[model samples]
Target chain A: MTAPSAPLVFLPGPTALHPRVALETRAALADGFLSESHRSPRFRACLVAMEEALRSLLEIPQDHRILIVGSATEAMERIIEGTVTRRSAHLLNGAFARRLRDVAVNLGREVVEATVPDGQGFPGSPDRFRDPGVDRLLDGAELLAMTQNETSTGVRIPPDLIHALADRAREHGALSVVDLVTGWPSEAVDPARMDCGFFSVQKGFGLPAGLGILVVSPAFVERARERQARGQVTGGYMGIPALAQVADRHETRATPNMLAIRLLAAVAEDYARQGREALDGAVRRRAAVFWNAVVDLPGLTPLVEAGPSRSRTILVVEVAGGSGPLRDRLARRGLLVGDGYGPGKGRHLRVANFPVQTDPMLERLLEGLRNEV
Target chain B: MTAPSAPLVFLPGPTALHPRVALETRAALADGFLSESHRSPRFRACLVAMEEALRSLLEIPQDHRILIVGSATEAMERIIEGTVTRRSAHLLNGAFARRLRDVAVNLGREVVEATVPDGQGFPGSPDRFRDPGVDRLLDGAELLAMTQNETSTGVRIPPDLIHALADRAREHGALSVVDLVTGWPSEAVDPARMDCGFFSVQKGFGLPAGLGILVVSPAFVERARERQARGQVTGGYMGIPALAQVADRHETRATPNMLAIRLLAAVAEDYARQGREALDGAVRRRAAVFWNAVVDLPGLTPLVEAGPSRSRTILVVEVAGGSGPLRDRLARRGLLVGDGYGPGKGRHLRVANFPVQTDPMLERLLEGLRNEV
Candidate 1:
């Protein structure tokens, strides 16, 4: 069977973009997405198609605002700049969570940190309402933010905990924003229970890295509108209200990565035909193949405790020989696994099973590791 | 010769993209540009290739800073936001120039407007510049900005008048920034004499859009650094110093539209091998052929007067029967030209004859116009 083309598989993020994406991009370059007005009827049709597809896939409230922009980082920063006028508590456990703190700090927001040692899940049970540390920070804060999936360490803070957390924030008059870059259906976090959430198109959506999808609560958008009127613009690209205005007309403010959208439309159509449970089942099945292989390897140990609560799309492992030499050897053999992100250096290696990680591909990755480790 | 492919030509702004542009984009989709570091050796190599090629083709100064960004508008906005503070005088005759005023006004900078009625070249002499109307606008303005070719109305401002205007601005301690999107070498305006200039990949380059090339005078960059240190952080993807930092690396700040860059590299190589004069000659010759065939046709009149000062790449024609009916007629005949831009509505139609325009393509445009007009 053509020796199974040397799997140049991606680790979830910067996922494999569909071929249609390129076809449309080529068309866009020739047709010039910006050649027509963003308000044009044809342009509006494109936005409406994507928005409707997104609403069905994510099970988000139809009333929630969807603002597309440059990156998830830009969306997170905008959320901070718009919703949090006073101090806010930032929950940290992995690289993406730390990124939230960094963006908040850059935007001149007063950030209070909630600490969790690496390789650990969110404190205790999902039902546990509040962390004393988070509570102290949220005393006079305007918002509470966290990452639903710490892709760095392969941990998923249970959705029940997130609902409790969001409930607490509401009691304190603070909004809650979540970075769900890799979580989504795997954890089955009901969007009806969250205030806001965002993800980069590269991850779960299987599109290119340039576009970000944001789900902003309508109440928060009201706050963003007020912030915008005051001339307090957070980002050049992620002007929420500006994007909403364009989106209201069924369009995007900038010439969107139309190629990416076309591919997304194709995938969304496929998912709709198959059903969410079927897609989720496929991801789980792929995860199982990888999980079984990792447990069998003598020199490899699963980094995060494997369970339904942990990331089903990502598998973090601690290599017996350590990160430096092992990663180098794997690269020489032409298999690129994720390096330990941020502060998780040398001790951790991440493997992401997202979008279309087939059983054969997972087997190949494990076989490559078995020979090396 | 396969019926010469029907000349499927339009204004080069929406010109057909080379198939390779799409092929490369499809290849890159598997691992999007953001998957790698902007500072990585590979991306650096891409930048070096583009910069070296652009430098040779444009005849730009080695010491000048040339940056690649998302779009031509981004480049235009960057130049103004980076170089001009407090106030700037904008010479407006078409849509593009008016947009510059909008950008300046959006940035909270005071803008002095110097306007000539649409569809007219800068008055026969220098009287317009020395008039009380323009003099009042120039007072205390930090920079003078204008378009090299007002493609909307097919008016090309004389570079000597521009040089004189820049010289005048310099006397008043102001700089000159120009947008040469469709005007590159088809009309000569040495960037070596201006403080800043901007263009895009699509029109004159005969490549796809999505890439903006900005050339900054060394003096302009130095002044920008001084202003940035004073905490003047402008919004938009074109935050000057941030953009310049990425440019300093000779790489893009965000994941670049790599396919566009590869296509642009091919274009630059073709131009370099053919030499600038040959490229410019081809454009002028085609413009001559198209204009010669249609200029005297009934219900059509040239927008810009015939002279060396006219844009060699574009021929703007006022639809003597009014824009609507003529625009519709051309479209029905299977030829598309740009409709009036900004204030030029119902007054003009634009025919672009840039690098991509060929003699045979010119014939098809005339044939279509002949049947309609």
Candidate 2:
């Protein structure tokens, strides 16, 4: 019945939003800053606050710059366009991994395809760079790209693996990029290890869509400038250097998504105040609650098993009779989980364990799975 | 001292926001649709509703398509990238007009420049084609582009000028594009006349900055596809055909600003109910209050002499001293107004008369100008 009109969202990408975000958003709306010119000192402060909050929360290094973009898709486009000139290698294990490959291809870059089957993980588990296929792809590549967490499948190749891949790319004399689209806040994507890493706020930050966060190393910035110098398109109005130039003034090249950006700063500042360890504990605690509830249902089991590859934030379960019926039954109880992504569409149900989803909400969701499903 | 903490925003852009838009934005944030999947039917409906509301409000013809972009700057990039292949003719007078030419040059397109002095608009009041320089710029150009309303200099080339320019472009076997960024809602940008027209919502729409509206004709769509066929870049992630394809499904290439989009739809629906004439009368009425109060101020006068060239929605006055002193003086009284734009930086003060700016707000601002300045 349309999920009881006001259901708790559990989608993978634009997951459950915190009421605090909504409250802060409303407060921002009421303030005069909502209508402030992006060039104003007040607007500049908002951008600085957002950047500083994110820096403190993520412990981002001084050398890495945070560039705000339109969306994660746009982030992907920007990273590939701004960084990769001739050859880029993609590690495709899921839909989003393939998406990077697609973005690179769309930009007419030479893509070195490295893929595993959709449901399968790299043979070396978390140490994917140890795999021969990945090694082959990195060879002779100008840049290597992979998703730190693949939302399409409930596969997360932890931060350590991203670090390892970056090291591998460096050994091969290539830069590295990471797509942490659904794996930030809950998981740290250490930017120091890679040339670039990016995500959107709607996934883990409990904010609305429309903001893309790109963390680029100084070398990466140089590479984008080099691309521009070489007569390659480094983003026209959205050119990497152009955005960075205005960003230094605490503004954007084009009018940015101010509402979403401000809300993100508030949320990030909240997380920083709470500290990352507490956030990690709470996230783990909530995932356990949902994982404990849904894993043993009749003919239903956790996808990716419990391993290094399993996602901590997004929990996916494969249903024997397709996800539609189970999701429909859950919908009847006002619980809305995500449908399977791509190949797993009807066969899987993806549930999120973001910080915004409180314990009691998870309990209610668990009860829905137990009694309703 | 800081504009009384809640000054009315009368900046040329990101203008005074309406409380209705704030309320509607808050409502949208509270709703679960904020976290809903962009692929969901509910999200599709939001897209459709926004499109329909705009179509009804702008009287958009059947052949024209509405594409939602990141910002008006992005809209300009998309139109130039999607439609223009080789050579483009730019009619420039003010900053934002020069911006399109900047965008074209940035995209590596061949630009033929035509211009009038900043304060002095085209020789003929409404019809710019009477100028020999404008006539020459149109010849042998693949596309003719000009700003319908120059936000920087308070000059508006009326709809009739745009229509006449479009006729000239067609006669020259070229397409015409118009930048109605600060002009829309207060001024109707008829999609039926121009091949492409665009604006951002933060202007006369009385909303926060983020969303951009692009209305493209069928012929314009065909031109974009043809550009893509010839292997020209038509916007990578924001490719016009790709955006149009998703738009048909009631979605965008990127995760859109659902909050802004929904609020815009609500506002557009509200305006549609009030009818265009009511909005026109209200805008003009509000302008009169501020204009009458400021026009005869000591050593102050209108920027554009008087007549068809002057902007009605954004009323700019030439302050004898740099606009800073007067703006700072008014700020002490909590009535914020726009400073001079670009080359006019210190010499002019721009005041907006959007529907959201109540008569009392303008009265307060005028009183500040009369008594303080």
Candidate 3:
């Protein structure tokens, strides 16, 4: 079936574009700015502005380097290829986290994984490692990987647990990398807590896909350099050293998604004007609205326990019946939410509560659900 | 200084976007299609349409697989990482070709390179290997890589020679890879001639940057699978096997530049309607106009020798009094061209002659050059 003339999309990611960002992108196209050389002063300014805006919006530390890549999956591969010389330890909670472990294995790195059930969130706070099994897996590993917000199951690792895990990895002389794909500004991330972290613009940032932002700590760069020096094969183009070298001059190693980069800068500038506290408060309010609306809906139950472990960005609900009919019903009303991911396919529906979802849109989605259910 | 309100960007790609393609992209954005899930029928139709359009426009053999990637540079890295088991050989003509060698070396592969001065085309016709040195380098190599058109120096390899080189590599049991970055539909590429070929949307296709199109033959896929089976590392997301697997269903490994992909399909469909002979003839006409206008211009000399060696898509000229001032002069007049690439730095200027450069723009550029020089 053909999509409606103008559908209100609320998919988990490749989420709705902020209207202002979309307008700016259209203007960019009209102005022929995409034709400019990546080295041109205008394009370079765009890149610099994006990097600066992200650093400010995310509170990235001075020691960390921000590199724009192709996708979050690409960032995952780069991090594993660059830092993991021998072994990588992964704490897998859902599809995305399991994909990280698979990437490491595909690259022929020795993998140690500690996996929980799909919908279960890791138990712990910032002060300690609650899972002894994961802690043991991190030992002797060159890289420790985790997903801050598991998109597939709507489970978010507590910020305190993330910080504690990075500390533990540091103690064991392993670099820590976190996939913040679905939990960046909305969920509140501190780049200083981890050696490297990545997020895609299509998710919480509310922009089109294509660009992946990778924040690298000095220690991570050093690890990659040491690995390269020791004759280990770090990748090209996405390699840490090459990316770092180009990023020093506010450039990318390859031609990037210039339109997305420009759009991100505009969105980041908006965030700057709105202030972090205000943005965070809006996200919190939206998450509450989403949870309250869906929690008691007939046939729908929250995927993750309602607590610190629930994701603020993506709200996943387990459906008693197959999600296909319900999703089709929503789509018929021009409302779109993500289908179940991986094994959750047809059983769960993922709704994104990004900053771009206006209150009216959220209300409409709720109205549609109420009518359908 | 700030750019003009509407500067006419002539910078060799990301080149100016075709007006129709840009409008199509804007319409797609307005439709909220970018937010659709990659697996959604709407988005899948887009991917399938793009692959089909490209195959039809470029006359790709039925056995070839067309994969969409992030950028041409990423395609280079993937081809090298997947195909080169231990030894790979490169024929270096310009910066981009040297980059292929660097990618191989950076990935810890043994690289053998045959070198020629920049702007110098390989000698001889399609029947024989003109350079014994290059022939020697290809021996015992698992993959032989070359560039169909080097963007750095405006050097285009004759199509017949490209096919002959692939044949030579096949005789040596090595797969061939060609970078048709700036020369594809405009240059009449035959996909059956090479094991694999790649091009970016921004260059020859006259679309926005970000999406790279890679065409691979069954032989290349077999080589990559064999290498993987032999325990050689074959990357993760951009790996040939993964890309091939995803392409079978007309999907990318990750969230791609959906907008660019859509734009490419539209442009390719336009090309399909226009037909190949017509497209090639237009390129030929544009090249003639560009050359005739600049051939007798004072202080400007063509970079490559005239005749079969000259590039039809990009024209490089050496400036006696430095290209910086001339380029700025053109920019102030709302015209832009590429600055010197690689070591050419301040001494040369590059102009793109893609299908998107309208007759009026071409005349305006010629007039601006004549007056300035």
Candidate 4:
């Protein structure tokens, strides 16, 4: 019952995986990458390189522990479930934000959802977190979880607001766990400055899906150790301790999607060689190209107001007059975009503008959408 | 800083990923597997095929619910943590068996361990499950857990004993969860009658390492739902409900390693067209071919006693007289076998004889082992 092969063009994160990276992945798999001892100097070297590459990309200091996991969702759930030993507040602005809250609640943690409109992103100030309900909610809370870039909606939560909240949460002895699933070097958030930050590999690193990169402060590691001591340790195949052990060996614990990991390293190298500033410039340029094109399309309305607050990797577009058939028409023409998530579902589509959002590809997609509409 | 590609040959359980699978995986990545909806008929069809193929391979009833997850470990943990609401007795004869026990205990279940020598294989009597300690442990216990095939030490637990243990646990109002990480068509057991059975795609189906196939009985599923209603659901990426929903879809919830899934379907089709008896016979024949060749090799001793009770898919060899680098010598000959895990660590090397354990491959490995010794 497995489906036959189908040709697809991506308007999603990191678009098509880089061809060279893909080639390296195939070569590594063909050459038998999994059999190597994870602790071998070569594997450990890969781990060190991966950590350094990501550290440089995130503009983080060397002391932060970087563990690469299977996906952003895995890291998000692990951090929330593993680090949050008691009650916590989850700041929700979009679908992924709500997913974080759900993860906390599912883990049997006491969770209070701090709400915001989907398209509005997170509120611009920390005043919203100062309410009596919020204070009561924070009474026994041990963590404040939020998302930096809500990929479900084209909204970006400002890092300053995040830092502000982190400071407040700290006053109540709570840690901050951020789901920067699509934010990283492109947006220039320093991981060392935050308690814990995570992002998806496919979105920011211009690689294939399957790998997630997480940066945790040493404090988070101590908390994890405490959880382990309390016999509350949950084994995520991608759990941070397991990941750290594997990362220390510069290898994955299980046979990773070797193809994806290899491609990720190659993509990281490509970024490093080009320099972070150059990569950031490329991302900004690509986002501008795709966003501008989507704005000009007759049947589509930009989902976010023009400002620095908007996501640089995803462009949310509302089909003019809420036409589902029009969206389907664009999809049929090989312009695959994400359906709006959460409250915006059925009325919006998300177009990714990460590093893989090439000028030519975006132009072609825009032309196709126009012609189809 | 990706490491240089080495020419290491994996004895392959985490076997050398097939080049064809890797090729298709690259194709999947380029074509966008993640961007597709899970509920789509295309993915659902894949799920159905995978489940059917698994049932056919294991000779299980159509009524048994089949679920696929990231790895065999995830499935094992879910089954143990989900069903066993109280205490449990764990039968430990190998590394993976102990891991199952660890998972159960870590989830707040009281675990009573039943011990056996690492290389001796499972005891012959069901009375072992009726031990006073085991009986006492089952007072408030919700299940008895054990591994079918001890992949680490090449010991296959006796099915009658396992069935007896399951019956005893059920008599005490408990369930039975089996970590059949290596058990497959090597022997026959009716999964419909068992509470839960788990396996990884790599060992038996000869697929990549990413997909784990889990089959469960109606009794266990009902108990899990009851627990969920009580808000006592244990959370993990491998939670039973989430896995069940994906299982119901016959699709993986997260972006599956698509190329591997597709390859698994193709491999399953190969086995199906060839018939179960033929495939099982082939696996048995391959095991004999290697076992016979190694039975008299100089300085090599069969770790397990010779009989049908031994795991046909894995042959554990102990160095004769004393341990003096026999495993290292074989590896030098490009024959990659597993180091004895846990108690057997360093004393034995495990050679797997799964579906991919082809005649030529065995002949070459044996010839190399013979020459080296």
Candidate 5:
């Protein structure tokens, strides 16, 4: 499945680098964004502009501070390091969610984990946590973390459930961190409601991979700042308070991926100009294009049968046979989508409904699945 | 003095994006390096090839393992985190060298630091650390770290002196870590001798900022691996052993800046083709062009007067009276170099001798100094 030649990438995370976004890299060079100093006023301006664009595109609350790190994986570590003092809880259903749990464990913190098996939604499925247990899970925990849209299994914890849990965690003195890696802008997020939410631009912004954005609510920042002010140990560049210290100046402590930051600013501006409703509708429409065709496609069936828990960004499907056949068929038509993640690796297919996967490619994918599967 | 429109950047770090290196980002998009999964074979192959090119260019020994990180600053944090078990010693004379010591301190390690005043070199300067005291610096240290070419001070610990110190550290059971951030292929390095050498791609490689490269000796890897195997706590993604585990398979634990990695590989390959002599000669030639003009250029004088301890890469000069007037004079001619780092910010000048500063730019800079200064 190493189709470096494929013009279209429908993989859940990377998706496709939309032509508009791809051209931004060229613009970065033309405008000398590459050679600009990280300490310069120009870089500061770029940071301020990027923050504004991200705020407009994602409707981030005014109280949250946005940080640029390496990847969502990095975001998970920094958040856990900065926010959690002792005990942290995780709701896991897929590979990425588990990665956060692993990050905490590696950091030598107490971890409490609740899991729903692959191919099942956390709330829509029969059972993972009882109502009372949900209360117990947040109790005495410093932080609670989960992925909003699990890219691996195409299962989404309902947004309302996320807000509910955030509220519950707050009541129990726990901060909630949401990893909305593969779904942003299209999957509306309120940083205030979630407490702390982070995502990678390559996933939904249709840009090259590298930089990660972590948005921390005022409560989250206050908690971390309090901890730092109390003389608790902190990390270096990626440390919570260390990053926040420079973020106030519209700068990063270390030299960042300037070109990527510039590209995100440009792409985020594009999304803002396209209007949030139009952007979200495009995502919903393309996802529905695949979902509606599931009945006609011989072997393909939606992974999350419950519409309430299904992900509109990363659409997971279970082929009647192994996913290999359908994936191979699609490869023949020069289309590439992600194979199953974690336990579902070889048995399922994950298709991206990112803004970059335009109609022509979607049609090609649908035609390939219909005729060949 | 950010000259984004100068068409040339002579700054110390993020020197200048060579035209050849800039084109590689475009190649990345065309080849789908951006869309490819980090865990895929293609990325593995890219890593393998990049390692090979880097080895050839830097003359890294076969026993060393190369790692791709976010920045040299990230490398400082990770290296200090992984390698030092209890105590570390630092030979610091500049801002960047102090950064490593600070990283160790943040990680809660016992730090023994030795320092010399600015505008003076370690070996060339008289009376910083006595000969007997020098022995004590590395005596009980778990690791000894220093910057080979202090980009901030334009001072260098000559390679032979570095080897002497590394050998002495080894005798006392300590590891050597070198931050040749702004000097690499241009200033030769031996990973076996240095133990650990890390640099940012934007520096000597003449590429966009984002990625850092760390080359570790076999001993460095073995020590970290043994610690991990013994059930000692390690980091998550950037844990020495965790990174090594995937480095074996030629992949990063997280999705890296693939485009930056590709550009480094391409630039390294280009240097290999140009041969090490030509590459190093180009750097020396540029530095000599500036060093030779010191007498003629009225306020600007080489900061490190001792040629043996002076950096051929980051040429630091103390501006008589102040650097403001001379910097403005050069600015009018559309040339931009770095301002002195740390305390020397407004009083000294730092010009880069990176490969991207071709003869024409060098001539323009020299002419500006002669006429305007």
Candidate 6:
């Protein structure tokens, strides 16, 4: 009468929910946590717990404030609106980075972009921050935006490069914001190094797709306050000043996704219990295994050039002919991988190496890939 | 090992999740709907089905469009940004109405408000829209905003009054928007009469708290286009044009709460099966029972004036002493009613009489109220 259960999903994100987190979310739902008032002390406790857990797991600095929002894209919009006054520069190499640039443009900000091919990393090395060309672009920009992990192409900007760019942006009197949507606890990056960074819970956290966790340094808050003082239209609900004021009291400017927030807190607590190094090591081990298998596969090649450029969390590979048949075969075999993003659709397969991916699931996926090839 | 389950929550909102909808949501979660890509046809079907179900249940006209957003507050922000070019007028009777007014002000619009005290309804009768005083306020306004059901005060504007005011706004070349956050389907108001009307899923829909359904008329869309043509900011992710374009394909502009959307579709489908008139009649019957119980209870008086002004969905009562001890007594007995909203915090209690309130639950709440008194 009823259809069979669907296979475990391994798509880029929202990735498979960790069973423990799912159980906690279910209990929360049944206990009426979702129905509690956002202004209630009960809900505030959830907020406080979530923030503390995330801070410990992400290693967020003491001065940084964590604001929960609707999505990572919203975080981008908020950061740009709250901080950018006159000009902003973007390092665009993939779809997500280009979206940040477009959001700035849509909000009427003056935007300067340094772009590279989709699958390629940002141009030049981290040392290029000293180059005059890079300095020229950053000169008058109020904010310099970059994607730490570009979900579209599975390319990661080296941590050294991100830090270098942030340092250069600071020299130019600009704040730097990074999007870590697909790369977070799995691949630890110091939140203290950037002015602001954000990620959605659906990616590395292996939760549902509603809540976006944004980390804002005190300097970023100061910039937002300056904009507010100038009576600029920072934003309405997504305004950083409003968000910070409410978050200070452990609340949101608007009603948030409580179930998702609770689930994230549970997941974050789990991560903290396992210890960050252990979790990151497990993720790295899984990534290594996945990368090795793809490299040995008959007709597949990594999307990003090998070395530090490839993302540890998202594995993208190009299919020699087309990816449709292989994807279909894998799907039939109960293994799911993401389709190519944007232009690469049908030509590449993107797989997630999130911490939640168990060894058995990975082995099954590899077997599926080998058989399909 | 675990603490006892939480009491049944009767908070104004996020209200209790209907058991049927909860079951559907849990099944959807297990089926991996939450993990599906926003661009996937699977997710699009959920969106399309939700819109169609809501349209059928709410009697939305053919020319009207429904856009799903993050919250009712977001719907307010989006409508204000998308429609109001320079000037807006608000009918402010309670906290929610004032919030709409504030949103316009925050977005930098010239807001002219016609205010009344918190416990009272809008000034004058429904026929007052025909009076010159209301016309004078609507004259130069680009958009006129009003709350059909002011959740904060438990005061609902009569359907006739809402339609009349909308007609007046149209005559004045302004679009009219209504906040039906706590009231919809429970009290059937024709959406064809207003340019826009919105509601959050947590209230009458008995789903989770993440999604807001916004119904937009063709006139509102045309006004948004005019604003866009004038180079005004129509919002980025919350923009009407972008939302409508994506909604045309049965998708949201950004990642949406898939679990909430699916649950809403299921609930709407159930409502449709039961018939709107029948559903509305059941709600009216429940409201009658609730009001009668409140009238009979000791040390209690209805907050809203008795005749035609009280909200059927949310019943507000002022207690003789403070409401704290009474609320505590109810909670101890496994009954939960909302604390008064805003200024009424310690002196009043707000109870929801939504369609999902079962007969047994109502009896328990009524019994609890009597015992507490």
Best by DockQ: 3
Fnat: each model in turn: 0.07, 0.65, 0.82, 0.24, 0.69, 0.62
lDDT of 2 by residue, B101-152 (tens): 8888877888998788886666574354756766788777878888877888
- lDDT for every model? 0.68, 0.80, 0.85, 0.68, 0.81, 0.84
lDDT of 5 by residue, A1-373 (tens): 2344565789876667867665777777667767768888887888898999988988887778898898888888788778887889999888888999998888778999889887677764323333778888887899989788888888888777788778778878999999999868677656768788898888888788889999888788788888777766567556888787677778898899988888888888888888777887888888887888887777778888757678888889887768987787786778888899878878899998887778877887887777787
Model 1 has a DockQ score of 0.23
What does candidate 3's lDDT look like per residue over B1-373, in tens digits? 1234666666789987777675787688777777887777888998889888988899998789998779999998999888887899898899999988999888888999877799998876876574576578887899999888889998888888888888888888889999999888777668998899998888888887898888999999988888888888788756998888888877778888888888888999998888877887887887898888787899999999887768888889999979999998998888888988989989889988887776677888888998888
Sort every candidate by DockQ, greatest first. 3, 5, 6, 2, 4, 1
In candidate 6, what are the lDDT values of residues A276-334, reduced to their tens digit?
A: 78887887788889888888888899989877788888888999999999998898987
DockQ-wise, the better of 1 and 2 is 2
Docking class of 1: acceptable
TM per candidate: 0.85, 0.95, 0.97, 0.90, 0.96, 0.97
- Clash count for candidate 4 is 3
lDDT of 2 by residue, A1-373 (tens): 1234678777876777866777777677767777788888977888899999988988889878889888888888878778787789988889888888887887778899767776566656446467786678887898988887788887877677778888989888788888888777768667788888888888888888888999888888888888788877776588788877776677788779888888898999998897777787888888776677666667778888676777878788898878898898888777889999889999998988776667777888888888755
Backbone clash pairs for candidate 4 read B12-B15, B47-B250, B313-B353
Model 3 chain A: lowest-lDDT 10 consecutive positions:
A1-10
Clashing residue pairs in all predictions, respectively, total 0, 2, 1, 3, 0, 0
lDDT per residue as tens, model 4, B265-333: 667666766676776678788877877887777778888888755887777888765443776786666
* Lowest lDDT 10-residue stretch of candidate 2 chain B: B1-10
Instruction: Write candidate 3's Cα lDDT for A1-373 as tens digits.
Output: 1235577778998888787676897688666678888877889999989888888888888778998788999998899888887899998999999888989998998999877898888766665574666568877899889999999988889777888888888988999999999888765667988899998898888888889989999999989988899988778766988898788888888888999999999998888777777776887787798788887789999888899888877888888988999999999998998998999999998988777777777888999999887
Encode model 1's per-residue lDDT on B1-373: one tens digit a residue: 1123233445536444434455555455444453443445665776677777777777788888777665676566566667776888898888778877876775567888878887677775544566666567678998899888876777778778777777777777888888888887455677788888888766777554446778888778777777767755442233566667777777765555555665566667667676777878888788777778776788787777788556777777877757877777776765667666666577677777876666766787788888877
lDDT of 1 by residue, A100-152 (tens): 88666655577887777777777677445555665687788777888888878
